[model samples]
Target: MSSESSQLHIFFLPMLAHGHMLPMLDMANLVASRGVMATIVTTPLNVPLVSRTTSTPTSTKINILTIKFPAAEVGLPEECEILDSDNSKDTMPLFIKAVGMLQEQLEQLLSAYNPDCLVADTFFTWATDSAAKFNIPRLVFHSTGFFCLCASTCVGLYEPHRKVSSDSEPFVIPSLPGEIKLTRMLLPDLPKTDAEAAYIAKIVKTVNETEERSYGVVVKSFYELEKDYADYYRKVFGRKAWHIGPLSLCNRNSIEEKLQRGKASSIAENYCLEWLDSKKPASVVYVCFGSLTKFSDSQLREIAWGLEVSGQQFIWVVKKHENNAGEKEEWLPDGFEKRIEGRGLIIRGWAPQVLILDHEAVGGFVTHCGWNSTLEGVSAGVSLVTWPVAYEQIYTEKLVTDVLQIGVSVGVKKCDGLLGGSIKREAIEKAVNMIMVAGEAEEMRSRAKTFAKMAKEAVKEGGSSYSDLSALIQELSVRRLHH
Candidate 1:
C-alpha cells in the first residue's frame, strides 16, 4: 500500500474538563508518535491549554481542531468554555447542554475530514451516531481504570444495590471475578438533590446508549495494571476494548513537558523542586485532590491539622475557585502555615503534580482517587493515602487499597458530592501514618515501586501498552482501506 493510504488518521474528542481532556491528549500524542495522523477536537478557549500540554517536537504533529461552545445559548457566561466541578453544581447541566450543541459542528468536521477512527470521550454519547453516519469506527475513551469500568458496568447491569434495604447496607457485585462489595451510599447513583438526581439520570442514559452503539472502548489503562478486570471487561461483557496506558508515561521524557501539563503551575516549578531537593528520598507526602473537587472550610482545616499531626513533610495543592482566587481562606487553622513553614507547602491553585510526584523526595500521595491521579501516583511509584470523594473514585480506592495493596484508605465510606464529606483530623492522620510512617508503609512503598517499574515498562517498545496501541493502529489502518 502507498504510504499516504496506509497512514491511519484518528480524531480524539475529549470532554471539556481537564481530567478528561489531558489524558486523551496524551494518548493522541502517543498515537501520533507511532505514525498515526492524530487530531484533537475541542472548543476555541481550550485550544491553548491543549496545545501547551501537548506541544512536543515529535515526528508526527497532533492537529488541534476547534468548534465553538454555545455558552451564551446555554445561559452560561461568555467565558465559560470548560467545566469546573467545584462551581458546576448548578451549571453542569448547562455545560453538558452546551457541549451537546457542538454536535452540528462535529458533524460538519466529520463529513469534511472523514477520519478513519473517532476516539471520543465517553461523555460524548452522541458521537456514536455521528461516527455511524460517516461509517467510521468510534472508540469510547474512558479516563478510568478497568476495575472501575467493570464495576460500574456490572452495577448498572445487575442493580445489585437495589437489593439493599438501606443506603449504608452492603451488597456484592454479581457476576464478577471476585467478591467485591460496596454500600449503596457509595454507589454513583446516590444523588442528594433533585437536580443532581436528574443529572445522574442523564449521564447514565448517555453512557448506556453510547456504549451500546460505539465500536468499542479505548481505555487509558495498561493490561498489567488491572489484568483481571481488563480480561473481565472483554471476556465477560463480550465487547471490544484496548488498554494502551498509564498514558502519563508519555510525559516522562521532559521536565518542561511535565511542568506545563494541564494548566500553568500556581507556584514556580523551580521553587517546588528546590524544596523537595532539600528533603531526603521518600520523606515527603504530596497531597492533592484532582482539579474538580472542593472541600468545605471544616474539611480543609481538618486536613491541615491532619497533615501537621502526621508529622510528615508535605506539599498540598488546594483547589482555588475561579472567582475567589484572591480571597483569604478562613478555613486554614490559625497560624497553620507558619507552624508548618519549613515542613509543609500549600499551593493555593494549580500545582505541577506530575513534576512533584516524580520527585525522589516525594513518597506518599494523599489522593482523592481520580483515575488520573491514581495512575500518576502509580507511574511515580509513590504509595497513597486514598480519600475518595466523587464518581467512581470510591471504586478506584478499592483498586488501590485492596487490589494493588499500594495504598491506605482514610476510611471514606460514601460517594460524597463535589464538596466532600468531612473526615476528622484523626482519620486523616492515621491514614497518612499507615502509608508513610507505620511498619506496613515499607511494604506499600515496595509495591508502588513494583507497579511504577511495570508502568514504565508497559509503555516501552514491545511492552503491553505499546503492543496494544500498535494493534489498535493496525486494526484501524486495515479497516480504513475497506472504507
Candidate 2:
C-alpha cells in the first residue's frame, strides 16, 4: 500500500433520513477502517444520534462534523427531522428546503478540509456541483441496492409503467435486460398538484445533472446479491459503480446495542431481547415495518389477530406514534396482548432491529422490505414474509421474493398512505405460515441462509465488496495526486 494510493481523505454528506444517514455512516466507518480519512457532514440535531452508535473514532479514522439545522426559520418544529417516523407529510417540502440550506456550510468545509473526493447522498443534487467548484471528484453514495437501482432506472427509461390502466395492471418494462414487470402504482409517484409537479420536475433535472457530473456511484449492496444488476449498472449505465455492502456489517453489534439503549421499547420495554433468549433457535418471527409504514387502526388489528393465528413465537415492534387521537385501546384486537403474553412480545418504540434479526431465536421476518431491513434480514439468514408498506418497497419485495427466491410475498400490492387500507389477517397468516411452518418453506430458509453467509464473506479481506472498496479508495488517492 503505497502512501499515494492509500492516503485519500473522503468527505461524506448523507441525507437526513435514518435509512440514508445510518448506512452512509456505516460506509464512512468502513472507509475509515480501510485506511482512508472519512469525515461525515451532518446537521447538529443528528450528531447525537451518530455519536451514540459510535465512539470518538480513535481506532477508526472517522469524524462527524455538523451544521445548524434551520428548523424554526423554515416554519418547522424545533425538532424537525428527515427520518423520524412521526414527521407529517406537509413537512417533507420544508425538510428538503432546510437541508438544502446546508450547501453554503458544506462548501466552506470542503474548502477547509480539501478532501480528495466528495461522497454525497442522492438527495443533495447540488452537491456534485459544489464538488465541481472545488475541482474534487464527486462520488454519489446512493443508499439503495443494485436491484432497486436497475428497476427504477429501467422503469424511468422505458416509461412502460405509464401505459398500465390501473395500479394492479402489471406490464413488462419495454427495454431491459432482465424481466421486470411493474404496474403504474409501483412506479414513482407523479405530481398531483402544480407546485408538486414543478418540484418533481426540478428534482428530476437536478438528479440527472448530478449523475452526469459524478466520478462514480457507490451503493449499499454486495456484488453477490444482484450480480446481473451490478453488471448492468457498469456496462449499460456506462458508470463506475461499486457495490460495497451489507453495510451494517461494519461494527453491527456496537451500533445496534447503542440504538437499543437510546430508547426503552414500550410496555414490554427490555423484554423483547430477553424474550428472544427464552425461545428456540430460529423459532421467533421479528415483525417491524422500518421507520415509516403507518398502519391504520383496522390494519393494526389485522396484524394482531394474524400473529395470534400463526401460533408462532414472535417479537413485534410498534412505534409510539401509531397510537393517535387517544385511540390506543381501539387499535388492537380485544385481549390480543393477554392471549399472547408469553408467546409474543410487543415493543412499542424503537427496537434494535439488526440485533433482533441476528438473534438465534429469530427464524423469520415480517417486513416492509425497505433496503436496510432487507439487507439486515439477508445478513441475518432470516427468511422474510414481505409486506411492502411504501416508497420503492414493492420493487424491493420483488427483488427479494421473486428474483432471489429467498422470501414469501404477502401480496400487499397497493401502497399505504399514512392510514391506508388494512392488510387482512388471511394475507398475514398465509405469508407467516409459509416462512415459519415446515415442509414447503425450507427452500426459502435455505436460500436465505446461503445468501447470509455470502453477505458476511463479501466484506472480508479478499471478498468482491472489499476489492471494490479498495479500488474506489485507490482511484480517489490517485486523483488526489493529479490534483
Candidate 3:
C-alpha cells in the first residue's frame, strides 16, 4: 500500500466456516493495516469466533457488524451458527438455506453502510445481486489456489474424467496450462442419491450464475506459486481474478496471532515451542489433517502405528471429540503414549500450526492438502507427506507431489466420502521416511525452501501480491470517487 490513506471502505462477508472465515479476516486485517476502512459482516454467534482469532493489534480500525443468524426460520438451534466436517453433510442444506435467508438483512446493512466494495465468500451467491442493487463492486473470495480453480473449471467444461472406465484411471483435465491428471475418485464424490444430486445441481447453477455476474475473484494465493494456472484462468478460462495471498502471512509477526488464527489453541504456546526446541534441527515430522476431516478409530489407530513405526519425532494434532463413551482410548494402542513418551507429542485439539511449521526442528509435514495448510507448509518450507482426504485436496496433492515435486504422496488413491479412508501403517511410515529422513528428503526440502522464499517475497512491497492488492484498492477507490 502507498503512503496515502485509501479512500475506500470494504465490507467483508465470509461463510460460517473456519476455513473460509479465517482467510477473510486475514484479508481484512491486511487491508485495514494499509489504511483502508474494513468491516466484517457476520452472524451473532460467529462474532466471538471472529473476535478471538483477530485479536492482533492494528493501527487502522476494523469493525464487526453482525446480522442475527435465522436459526428459527432455518429450523436450526440458535447456537448452530457454524458448520463443520462432522455435521456438514446433514446440516449443509439447512446452513445454505439459512445463509440465503440472510440476503435481506445483508442488503439492509449494505444500504445503510454503503461501502465502496463488498468482498464475500463464494457461498454467498446472492452477493452479486446484492452488490448490484447498491451499485457496488463485489469481489468473490475463494479460499483455494489458482490451480484448483483452473482444474475445477476444466473439469466442469470438459468432463474428461467421465471418459475413463474406472475411478482409478488417470485422465488429464483438458485444456489446462499444465498436464493435470486426476482420477474420478479424487474429485468431490458425485451426488449419491437423487435429492443430493439435485441439491448439488442447484448450488452449481447459483455459483455459475453469480460468478459470471460478479466483478472478479480474490484468490488466497501468490502469482508465483501457480503462475501458469493464474494466467490460464484469466486468458483461457476468461475469469477476472487477482492473487493477493498466501493470506496467512499477515499474521506472521505475532505468535499469539498465529496460534489464535482460527480457533483457540488447545495446548500452551510455550510448551509446544519448548518441545520443538528440544529436537534436532529438521528432524521432527508434523502431522495434521485439516479441521474438517474426522477419522474413525480404526483409521486413527493406523496413523498412530505409522508414526510410532516411523521412529521419528512427531507432533500430531487430533480433533477434539466430546467423550460420551470413552472414544479416546479406542484409537490408541495399549501403552502407546508411554512407549513414545519422549519422542512424540499429541495435541487433542487445535495446535498453533504456523508456529510449529516455522520451527527449525520440523522438517516434514503430513497434510490432507487443504489449500490453506498447503500454502502454510510451502511458506514454512517443509517437505510434505501428502494424504489428500477430500475434494480439490487431491489436486493440491498432485501439485505438491507431481508438479512441484516438493512432496511425496502417502499413496491414498481414493476418497471414501469425506470422513476419509484409512491408509495402512506401511504407506504412512514409508511417506514419512521419504519426506523426513530418506534420500529424497534433502532435494524436497531444498525445493520447498525455494518456494518458501518466493512466497515471502510475493507478499512484501513491490511483489506480485502486494502490487495486485494495491491495484485493487486503487481501482475500488477510483470507483468510489466516481460514485
Candidate 4:
C-alpha cells in the first residue's frame, strides 16, 4: 500500500452505553497501533468520560471529536453524558431521535475531515445515508455476540411467528445456522406495546437497510467462537464480515501495565481487587451485572442470602441506585456479611471487572451473561453461574451453559415455562455450593482454564482473530484509497 493509503484516518461512532463505548475504544486503539489515525465521535456529555479514558493512554494517534446534540427539547440530556435512567420506556425513543439529529453534525464533521471511512454502532443506522452523502465508506460494528445478532435477525425475518400474546409459550427461531437451538424464551423482548413494537420494528428495518449499504460488518468475535453463524452471515448477507475479538486480549499487555502502575482511581474500580487478594486460588465467586441490567430489592436480598448459605468466599459488585437504599446489612440476610466478614466483600459501585476476573482467586463468576462479561470470564478461565436479566442475555446464558458447557445456569426452570425464572436464596446457595464444593467444580475449573487459553491464542499473532483483524485493516485501507 502507498504511504498515504497505509496511514488511513478512520472515524468511529459508538452507542452511548459503557459496554459499547469500551469495545469501540479498544478497536480504535488497535487500529491506531497499526499506524492508522482513529477519531472517536461522541456526544458532548460523554466527551468527559471518553476523554478521561484516553488520557491515561500514552498513544496520541487516536483523537476524540465531540458533537452537540441538536434536539435538546426532545427529552435528551443536554450534556453528552449517559443518563442514569432505568426506564427504557423514557429513554430508547429519545435516544433514537437524538441519533438522527446528530447525523447533521456528523455530516459537517466528515466534510471537514474527509476521513477515509466511518465505523459506527449498529444502532446508528442513520449514519448510512450521511456516509453516502459524504462519499465515505461505512462499516457497521455489532457490539453484541453473533448468536444474538442471528437471533435478532430471525425475529425480524419471522415477524409473524415471534408475536406471541404472552412471554409464556416457547417459539422456535428459524434460520439459525449453528448447531444451537434458539427458543422464544432466549430471544430479546421486542417492545411488546404497540408504540414500543413500532419503534423496534423501525430500528430493525434500519439495521437491515444499513447492512445492505455498508462495505461490511465488523464483529468483536472470533471464527472459532461462532463459526456457523459467521458462515451463515457471509452466505446470506453476501457482504464481507470479519471476527476480531475478545479485543481485551489484543491489549492485555497494556491493561496489565495499567494495573502495574496502580494508577486506576478508587472511585472507578471500587476496591474489589483488594478483597480478591485476600482469597485463595479458585475460591472466590465474582458477581456483577453489566452496566444496563438492574435488579429489584427482593431479587437482591435472595442473592445475598444465597451467597451467605453457600458458605463460600465471594465478591459482589452492586451499583448504587435509587431503589437499593437501606443499610447494606438490612438488605442482606442476618449475620450474612458478619458471618463471612473475612471472606465476603461487597462493592457499591463500578468495580474493576476485567482485573477482578483475571485474578487467580476468582474461581467462578455470577454474571448477567453480557457478552463482554462472558468473554472476560471465559478468557480468565472462570466458570459461570448464569443469571440473565434481560435483552440477549438469556441467549448468552444458553450459549454458555448449553452450547459451550463452560458454565451452568442458576435457578433457570425451563420446564416450568418460566423464562429466566427468579431465584430464591436457597437456589443461589445450592448452585454456588454445587459449583464450589462438589467434585464437578474442579472439572469445570479445568474447562474454564482451557477456554481462557483459547481466547488468548485467538488474539495472538497468527491466531484466527489476529489474522482476521489484519485482513480487515488491509481491506479497509484499500477501500479508503480507492474511494
All candidates' lDDT scores?
Answer: 0.87, 0.79, 0.88, 0.73
Model 1 quality (TM-score): 0.96
Please give, for residues 1-483, the per-residue lDDT of candidate 2 as tens digits. 236345778898988887787788778777877778778888877777666554433337468898788888889998785656688456777988888888898999999988888989988888988999999889888867878877777776766856777777989865555677767665546556999978876777778679877888998899999998888878887877988998887756453342432233344424556777888989999998877566766788888999999998888888646556656567678778999989998877787787788878999999888898899999999999988766677788889877998888887656665443467898888889899886757888899999999999999999989999988887776777777
User: For candidate 2, what is the lDDT?
Assistant: 0.79
Task: Point out the higher-scoring one by lDDT: 2 or 3.
Answer: 3
RMSD of 3: 2.1
Which residue pairs come into collision in candidate 3? none
Is candidate 1 or 4 superior in TM-score? 1
Worst 10 residues of 1 by lDDT: 320-329
Q: Which one wins by lDDT: 1 or 2?
A: 1
Model 4 per-residue lDDT tens digits across residues 1-483: 236545788899988777788778778877777777889998776776666555545544569898876546577556534533253435766866766677788899999999888999888888888888888888899877777777667667866345666555655566675445544444556455999888778767878988888878888887777677778778875767888888766445655433422123344443456666767898999888866655656677888888877888898877545345564544556666678788788876566677788888989999878788898888889889888766667777877776678777785533221123467888788778766777788888888888788788888889988899888888877876576
After superposition on all C-alphas, the RMSD of every candidate to the true structure, in Å, is: 2.1, 2.9, 2.1, 3.7
Q: Candidate 2: lDDT of 74?
A: 88
Alpha carbon lDDT of residue 123, candidate 2? 87
Residue-level error in angstroms, candidate 4, position 38: 0.5
lDDT of model 2, residue 192: 66
Clashes (candidate 3): 0
